[model samples]
Target: MEQHNRFWRIALLSLPLGVFGLFVIWPLFSSFYYSFTDWNGFDANYSYVGFDNFAKIATDRLFLQAAVNTTIWMIAAIVLPTALGLMLALLLDSRVAGARVFKSIFYLPICLSAVIVGQIWTWIYQPDWGLLNTVITQVTGEKFKYAWLAKPDTALWSVIVAWSWQQTGLSMVIYLAGLTAIPGDLLEVCEIEGASPWQRFRRVVLPLLAPSTVVVVALSVINSLKGFDILYIMTGGGPFNSSDTLAMHMYNESFKKYLMGYGSAISVVLFLIALAIIGLYFRQLRKVDRIYG
Candidate 1:
């Protein structure tokens, strides 16, 4: 009977394992192999020119700029949304009236498609008749107009804000779940001990939210690195490549410029960076888990 059960279990897993190997693993290896070649991404004839593409990356000004921008995006994306989400989660976790309505309103942005969010924000940032500028002008009685998505200095940050708005809901939901996991009795005990709200949160609540923090941090980092759709639609990496990310750079090289080999190299670099961050995060999570346990 054990043998029969094992056989069925293996059989049940085989199809998914095979599919993953074929669709995911194989393509990943193929991209790595092609990164060494000078394929234009379409033609059948190509030659291996290894490390040449990678060498060019070192001197490529646009790539360098994209790398910096990506770093900024990664940082902003993780910090702002996570902070705002935690705050919102705490607010909604209370017995405040209309908490459910506020939650639904906050979460609505996350449910909208990225393209839609980009378009909506694009309208809001319009210099001549945008929602924001118009509101400012009306309230202040002074002509206030600035192209938020056009200037190099403001473009990247503007997009980051829009992306954060969409992402904050996800963080809030994750934190809400984490808050639910905390025992209510523990909070009551803290109250009974005359601990201030801040002390209760810092001493008891924060320590217990480690698992949720891990999830939120990991997801925020991954999503930030993968940012593309909003950037593509809103900025298109415009105003002298100011808002371009590593992923956008890869796409332009591979698809737009047809420098498949170079693009593959960029993708490899991105993958490695993401892998390193994930490794460090997992290590940190282990430490947190041990301390909290």
Candidate 2:
């Protein structure tokens, strides 16, 4: 009976492992294999070109531009949403009146799909009649009309603004959870010692929230790296690929341009980059834990 139970347990675990191997693991290795080829995604005339795709990606001017834009997006995604979220969390956690209502209002954006948010922001960014420009002109009493997402200079930043709008709510919720987990006794002790509000927060609240901060930062970094739907809907990597993120670039190369091999190479690079970021995040997290242990 014990052997029978052990056999059943092995069988149950093997099912998921087998499925993952078939679906996820197989595709990852296959993508690496295809990255070295010149396949057009379909056809019997495919040939392995031996690192030519990676070589091309290394030298491609447009790919380099996309990398820079992605980096900017990553930074903005990390900084802006985090700052806004922390602010909101601190305010709401103070037990202010109508705080729940404000929290709900802020979090509503997170429930909306990224594509829907992109469409709404697209209308807001319209040149002459858009809400943003219209409000700017009204407030400043000067005609200031420009295509927000069309210009190369403002394209990436515009998308980042929209992305941050949705992401801030998520960050706020995470920080709120962290804030609530903090021991009330610690705050009371700080107050008893006549510690200033800023000092208490800086010394007690922030340090205790390290785990939550690590999770939020890691999630934000990964999401920023994989940003696609919003960019796809808003700019379609348009205006001379000004808003092209790595994910969008990969999609365009694979489906639109029919360079499946090169697209696979791009995907591989993205995967490696994500892995490196995650690895670094864990390393820092371990160091922080040691210092605070």
Candidate 3:
């Protein structure tokens, strides 16, 4: 009877497992297979061209530029939000007057849809009558017309600023949770030892917040790598492809161009990049454990 019950339990669990495999695993493996072919995402006329798509991606100058832009976005996204979030977290955690309200205000942006944020910022970045340029002109007493999202020079950075504004709230909440988890005893001990606020943060708070830092950095990196919706809605990977990232380029190739095989190849490359980043994160975690254990 026990063995029969166990068999029934296993059978019941297999339903959801099977559904997941069919939807997720099957599509992943199929895409890998498709990457080796020259499938136009329709019709039956297709031939396997092993590694040709990957070779093209390797040789494509536009893809290289997209890769470079993605790297820049990743760096800026991780560093700027994290530093600002840490500062904000510490400030809000002090329990000042109306700090709760302030925290809510900052976190409100995180709940806004990326498409909405992109559209709003796109309007703000307009060269002639945009709010940003208007303010600059008013303050500086000169004409400050500049094509923020249209010019190759300022396009990428313009997107970065928008991305940062949307992402900082998430980092702030993560750091705020980390700050709350710190032991009160430890903080008191630091104070008793004549540690200044900066010294206490450097020596005590930061070391204890390492785990939160890891989480925030990893999430920031992954989100930055997968940056698509905002870029897609705002620039559509252009004003001459200056704002293209790997994700946007992949979407353009796969869906717009209907080159499913090439899109699959781009997906595979992106998967490897994500895997490498996750692997590096774990390796660093291990190193940290060894040093601090």
TM of each candidate vs. truth = 0.95, 0.95, 0.94
CA deviation > 4 Å runs, candidate 3: 1-5, 282-293
User: Candidate 1 — worst ten consecutive residues by lDDT sum?
Assistant: 284-293
lDDT of 1 at 276: 95
Worst 10 residues of 2 by lDDT: 210-219
- Per-residue lDDT tens digits for candidate 2, residues 178-219, read 899887898999999999999998988988888778878877
| lDDT leaderboard ranking | 1, 2, 3
RMSD in Å for all candidates: 1.6, 1.6, 1.9
The per-model lDDT (C-alpha) reads: 0.92, 0.91, 0.90
Candidate 2: where is the Cα deviation over 4 Å?
285-293
| Model 2, CA-based lDDT | 0.91
- What TM-score should be assigned to candidate 3? 0.94
Steric overlap count per candidate: 0, 0, 0
